[model samples]
Target chain A: MYRLKATFIKEFKLLSVDKTGITILFIMPVFLVFIMTLIQQQAYKSMSQSGVPVLLVNRDRDSLGTAVERGFSNFPVAQLTVDHGERYPNEDAIRKEITNGKYTVALYIPANATKILEQNVEEIMGRMFNKGQIANNTKVDIGIIIDPTANKPMVIAITSRLKQYLADVKTGVLFNIMGSKIAGMMHAEIKGGMPQEDIFSYKENYAFRDNRSSYQPDAVQHNIPAWAIFSIFFIVLPLGGGIINERSEGLFIRMRTLPGSYLSLLSGKLLAYFFIALIQFLLVILLGVYVLPLVGLPVLHIGSNIVPLVLLTVVLALAAVGYGLFIGTLFDTPQQSAVFGGISVLIMSALGGIWVPMNIMPEVMQKISSCSPLNWALRGYYELFIKGGGWPAIQTEVIKLSVFFIVCLAISYRIFQHKTNTN
Target chain B: MEGKACIKVRELSKQYKGSSYLAVNKLSFEIYEGEIFGLLGPNGAGKSTFLSMLSGLIKPTSGEAEIFDHKLTTDTELLKRIIGVVPQDIALYPTLSGRDNLLFIGRMYGLSEKELKDTVDKYLNRFGFEKNGSNAVKTYSGGMKRRINLIGGMLHNPKILLLDEPTVGMDVQARTSTMEFLNEVNEQTKMTIIYTSHDMEQANTFCDRVGIIDRGQILKLGTPDGLPASEGCKDLETLFLKLTGRKIRD
Candidate 1:
């Protein structure tokens, strides 16, 4: 055990001294977080500012109507004017202006609009009386046309609301003038009851604003944490290879001759790798919380959600280290371990939902992914971020990860035992 | 073999599981205390396999080796402490400085920090590695690296040191310097040194006694001077060539 401890310390020093190892451990992940934060910030800004650009043309000579149209102003829907002289512009000219993209909407109200309103009111009142409903409500239609260039959803929402408002106004006018009194007289004469009050309330709700033009898009919940977990996973490759390297180099023999056991040596290596992994996790989480929000990206709830994510992730990391050790013992060369080891980790990580979310995957794929420990890890993070979860929600994932650690460690020990007997 | 010595082997043999032949067939040898011994043979003479058995690196198909009055097959941990084997390969980490490698080796031997530091510096300076000790082993020449490999084994100053082809690929200056340094340490410490080499001349010059092993058997064993005198041959090399007939290569 003492000899093994010495081997562990030695191996750690070797890893620290290697320039490539140090960079992989400390520099790469930090740099990646920085770049990701910058991109996310820009995306959020653009999303917030994204708006449709529209133009308006009014050929109507009515001054009151023109003033009503002028009252509505927004950046997405801009009103551009085309003047007509006393003779008035031809309909063909108006169409030509609209077709050339000078205006998004065109309006024209005829000069005899007062006469039309009088005739339509009388005609509509006679039809309402025939149907046994109240009558003589004013009806008006200022001719309006929409450009094809306008967004379909925006046009639909606007047109539908306008029609509904017009219908409501007609009803309101009738009730204010005569319909309410008529109903009251009937109620006094027979039923001895009044009409019930109808409460009407309307408000608009937006989940996320269209602020894209001003800031970058926020990183969706899974991307950063999943990427962070995978970065921790990659640590296993180098650390496992370090053990194989020492064994092949006769360092173990030197160690055995010393005063320690194999267990102590392996523990020391696990300690070093675990701490390095912890540092990596902190750097990524800290950057996600502090640095990501600077350029318009909202920070993830790290203070509240990071603890369970880290606890489970650390357990997974330890399992991965053991898996690496298993491969190291099985393979003769570091290169062999690296190639097979990397591919296996990737496959398991993919199955575990590190590369992709397991929820959207096919049933069979989900089942297969569930077999991987990473699947539970990502799901735990997803719960924290998406499901508003706390410790209780992630307990299952932690337990699953713990099981994986135990199983992989047992297998690793078995392989080590077998190899030690022969080599 | 007749006496129960510090180390003993009887009808010891090993056949690599997948191979068609035996590496060491019914091999046998013995060594006593307070002696500098050499396992001398040409390439492929099973010198390595022989030493490997004593070090307990691999299990014999049907044989046994004991070290320091303990059976190697049973008391592995105790055997490990009693023997230190410097492999034929350069096993030190290339990325680590010489001192760090020594400290690491010292730790494996269960030495404390101060003790390790003292032992590391003592060996580093003794081996003339003062200026280059701080540099990574990768930057050092072949000889310097080999010396470090040798030092790593002896950091705990084990009672026994086994070196396999220690000077196989070094230049003249490095070869002489390393051998002389080892000789001085061996003489002063009175530690048993079991070294294997193809250089009959160096072995003849340095070893207290030598064994000419061929086909996993000790063909001859005597002091460097006595072997030739008994055989009535010219020198150690001539006797070696005569004992093991020359072929182009094995």
Candidate 2:
């Protein structure tokens, strides 16, 4: 026990005095967190400040004998001006506006829209020919021209909405005018039947209240916090590698021979590195909660679930250190141990949902991630913040992470013992 | 004669796994307290393997060793506490200051900070390492780095020091000063020092008793002057050549 204690103390001494080690442990995490937070804040702020812009121009005459514009006049969109009444504007003007890149969609409504609507045949044909540049050999040609330079998503959105409006009007007319005609046709078809049933009328007779509303739940919408949490969580690599360095340096050998057992020595190094990992965690969380908020990524949501998330991260840190110990024992060289240790952590994080959002991953990947410590880490945070889960909600994830911690430590102990035997 | 054997090896043998050759075969020897013992041999002679086993850096495959009547196999901790090891290969941290390396090693032996600091400072000054004490070891000259390495292992005042070629690759002045310093420590503190070296003259002058070993066997064990002179053999070198029947080259 004394030998192990000596080993632990010697490990601490080496860690404390090593300039390279101190910088890696203390400076790297904080620096990376600060840089990551700054970059995320900048991105989030830029996204929030911008909106899609669209323009519409119309020359069609309405039934009131006044020119009707293509879009609503009070529509809350920037650069939504109509073409000049007396001036003839070419397609270049519309292209120029789109080319300026501010407007996402620009619409051009042809003149004499009333002429085409005067006849139902022309109106029906206009649906297929508008924006298509097809020949219409009738009273007059009417069309809505769309700028080719506009974004495809914006164009799709505008066209879909316009089609919906037209479809709605056509449906209203069909239901009102064809209802009685359709009833007569149905009666003729069912002439031999005992009775004819009107499904719509029957549904109307059994009236019921509608109590549904659309509300999009966008909790944890800003990505800055997510980025901060993830970047901070990766500090496990360097911290674990630091312990491995001590082992490779023969500090463990020295300490193990110092009248103490290996357990005490292992415990001391574990506790020292654990405390350091905790400090790293706290620095990142404090920055995420207090400092990141100042840059428009305020604590969007840190519900009661945060406790489990933080605890789970700490557990993962322990697991990472255990992995370091395993690598240290398996490899004799510090460089080799660092390489294997880094790759293992990266694989875990990738599978655990650190690299990609879990919801978008395939079902198989999601299931696989659940077994990863990184996955538990992300879930612990997501539940507390995004899902607003309480302790009970995160208990399962916490338990899994704790199990990972225990398993890792067991593996580490076995490998170290084996190495000592061989030595 | 303190009546205490600093090191006692009996029927010690080591056969590495997967190899038929015995690195150290049935080696047995003893060194009294306050004496310098040299295990001399050529390359592949198993001198290092034997030294490592005695230093508790490794366990022997067969038989065992005793240092100061403490069974090495069972009481390794007690043995390690009194023994300092200066490995043949440089073990100092290349990136750490010389002083920091000494302090780090001193602390491992449970020395108080103030005492370690004073001891390190005194040793560094004596070894001409004080001025460059804060310089990284890798930046120092080979001889300077060797001095730091030696001081690092000895900072805790261990009763027995085990060195594997402590003066190899050093200049004549550096080698001479190092031997002189070892002689001073052996006389002043009565520290039992065992070193492995191929340099016949250095071993002849520095060691009280030299064991000329080859192929895992000790051919001769006696004081430098006690070596059997032969065929116009005038000194330790000629006697060693005639005894081992092999010239020191390589």
Candidate 3:
């Protein structure tokens, strides 16, 4: 343990003197989180207010087409721009407009839309009033054109809202057609002898409930943990580079003469780097909770599960330090280690959904992301910040990160032993 | 006059994995207590390799070596505690101050905090760098770094000291000061020193006995004046050239 302390002190002192390394380890993460959160916040607000640029082509001159136009116009989240003409534009022209960036999305309501909806309503009334015999001969197909160049999230959001609006319109038409028939039946029953008080007491209420405390999307909740995990993984550059430099400079050979095992030396480095990782994690959290709020960004909350949050951060640091040691031991020169470490961290972070949320990614990519250690840490953070989950929610991810730490440390120790023995 | 053998090598040999040539082959020698022995050779002649094996940095392929009766292979931890190794290259952290570097190494050697502090301060004062000891090693001159490197090894005050080209790249003044300090430490402390060097003049003047080595084997071993007389040469350099040949090794 004393040997480990010495090693830790030595590594800590060495790293502390390196101004650039210190800045990257602490300052860079805070800066990235602050800037990214502010930028994403602005984007969310703009996206909500500006609304998706939608071009509506109405071919039906009846109430259904007008209803469709009015539905988009009344929707608070979409900008409804109607093209008034006798004929609807061709599919090719709509596609061209989308490609030209004139609009992000386009909706075409066909001439038979009103007729089809009316027929559906009539069939529904026949089923309810007559003995369940009805004819439905019309199919309602609304063509939606989306700009391929637009971001995936924008395209998905607009398409979802359009589908929801159309469904609501269909439901309203069905209700309108069924109301009068049900009223006539009620009137006949009342004359025979029914209570008017019961009819007036009929009430149905609708509300929204979430699994978590609340369902609000805020940038700080996402960016703080994501960038913090990214910064932790980046410990590879300085830690790995330092290891390579020590080997090349003959410090390892000199160190071998000391009365301690190689494990002690490695343990010392692990202890030091882990402390650094923890500090980085806390700084990012502090920035989100206190500093960013002052700048008008939403405050980040760690929910009620402090245990899992702390456990996950420590395990993540260990995993990152182990990875740094492996890279340091594998490479022969500082430059080699630097390039490999830098590029590998960036690639892993990107794959792990640090740059974009995993929910927005394709299914195949989401599956592949599970292999990244960064993904494990990010998932645990999301459970704490977004899901407001306690220990039961984040236990699996914490165990996985711990396993990653052990595996990486084992491999690194073996390589270090081989190199020192051969040296 | 020689004392008891501090180090003994019995046909020690090392052939690196996947390499055809032996770096050190069937070499046998002994250095007595309180003696300064020098291993002289050209580059790649296995001088550093032999020193590394003695320092317990690498394992020999065959035979065995014992330092102070501790086997180099089996009793490595014990041997490490008794031997001080100053490598060929500057091994101290460039970012750490000289004092911190010394104290850190001393702790690794199992010295108590108070002991380490006193030892570091004593060495710094003796080396005439007491005032500048707080400065980082990267800011130090070549001579200052060399002094700190030497001090780092001796902090534990081991019985056997192994130095590999300790004064290779220093200026004349630095080299002279380093040699003077080494001689003083040898005479005052009676520590057994095994040094390797390509500098014939330094070895000739500084070493009590010198061995000429080439091609993984020792060609000649004796007092400096005695080895040259046997080769019919006036100096150690001429004797080395005569035995190792004139070809330059890469």
Off by over 4 Å in 2: A1-49, A53-269, A300-310, A331-347, A413-423, B1-3, B228-232, B243-250
Model 3 scores what on Cα lDDT? 0.84
What lDDT tens digits, residue by residue, belong to model 2 across residues B1-250? 3346878889999887667888899998888899898888878788988877876767888988888889878888788778888877676666678887777677667788788899999999988875789887779888887888788668879898888888877888888888899999999999999899878888878888888888788988877766645334577777667666665544
Ranking by lDDT: 3, 1, 2
Could you give the CAPRI-style class of model 1?
Answer: acceptable
Better of 1 and 3 by TM-score: 3
Model 3 over residues B1-250: C-alpha lDDT tens digits? 4779988999999898877999998999888998899999988888988988888888899989888888888998888888899988898998899999998999888799998899899989988786999999999998789889989889999898999989977889878988888889899998988899989999988999998888789989999888899879999999999999899999
When 1 and 3 are scored with lDDT, the better candidate is 3
State the displacement of the C-alpha of residue A412, model 3, in Å, after optimal TM-score superposition: 2.3
Worst 10 residues of 2 chain B by lDDT: B225-234
- Angstrom error at residue A364, model 2: 2.3
User: What lDDT does candidate 2 reach at residue A286?
Assistant: 70
> Distance (Å) between predicted and true CA of A84, model 3?
5.1
Q: A1-423, model 2: which lDDT tens digit per residue?
A: 433444455456666667776676666755666665566555444433342355555555443113234333433322355554344365566666667774666655556544454445434444544544435545433234455664455456555654544444444434433454445657743233222243454322211122212312132222433444344444445545555655666444444434345566567666666666666666666766777667665454455444666676677567655555556556766677667666766776678766666777899988987787667767666656555566777678778767776876787778777766654
